[model samples]
Target: DAGVTQSPTHLIKTRGQQVTLRCSPKSGHDTVSWYQQALGQGPQFIFQYYEEEERQRGNFPDRFSGHQFPNYSSELNVNALLLGDSALYLCASSLVQGSNTGELFFGEGSRLTVL
Candidate 1:
């Protein structure tokens, strides 16, 4: 079965620009979450989507948004990006087991460079 996939493995943008990243979840999975990993920091959760709705969000600014489709795929969009927004954007998918003990399968991240 196919695993999580992210698009445009790499991207280059400048300040005040907007970017959109896509993700397709693994087969049989239903939840998709986005994370941002800065150069020297751990991944920071951006938001999560479930059943076509935003189920949870992290400590990110409102400029970050997302969407979930019926097939369990998702997208992350960042507006008015800043140089500091440059990072490895990761997309993770996992089964919605109604608990927090499930495993999250991550895709090769989309590297964004702001110049």
Candidate 2:
């Protein structure tokens, strides 16, 4: 029961730098989704990955992408980050279970601050 976990709990970097956040899904989950939450706002879905491919995506730009491994862990990569990118990078995992809509479980998140 590892639940969802993220690395670099707190990160600080200048604009234009790149950052990679990691996540491990809860036990027995096959799908992982990435979300971005800014101050005072709900998490927005960046993308959802299954079968090692992106199953769905939100309105985020190309700079935002992710990968899901066979073990159900995932990583989110953001390149040429901008000041606006400063936010809580949350990784939510859910068990597909053949459901039309899945439930999400969240991690503590990797906090990114851009200067």
The sequence of per-residue lDDT tens digits that candidate 1 reaches over residues 1-115 is: 9999999899999999999999999999999999999999999999888889988889999999999988888999999999999999999999888656269999999999999
- Per-residue lDDT tens digits for candidate 2, residues 35-115, read 999999999989998889999999999999899998989999999989999999999888776744478899999999989
What TM-score would every model get versus the actual structure? 0.96, 0.95
lDDT of 1: 0.93
Kindly report which residue stretches of model 1 are placed more than 4 angstroms away from their true locations once superposed: 99-101
Largest TM-score belongs to which candidate?
1
Candidate 1 at residue 98, lDDT?
Answer: 68
Superposition error at 95 for model 1 (Å): 0.5
User: What TM-score does candidate 2 reach?
Assistant: 0.95
As for candidate 2, its clashing pairs are: none
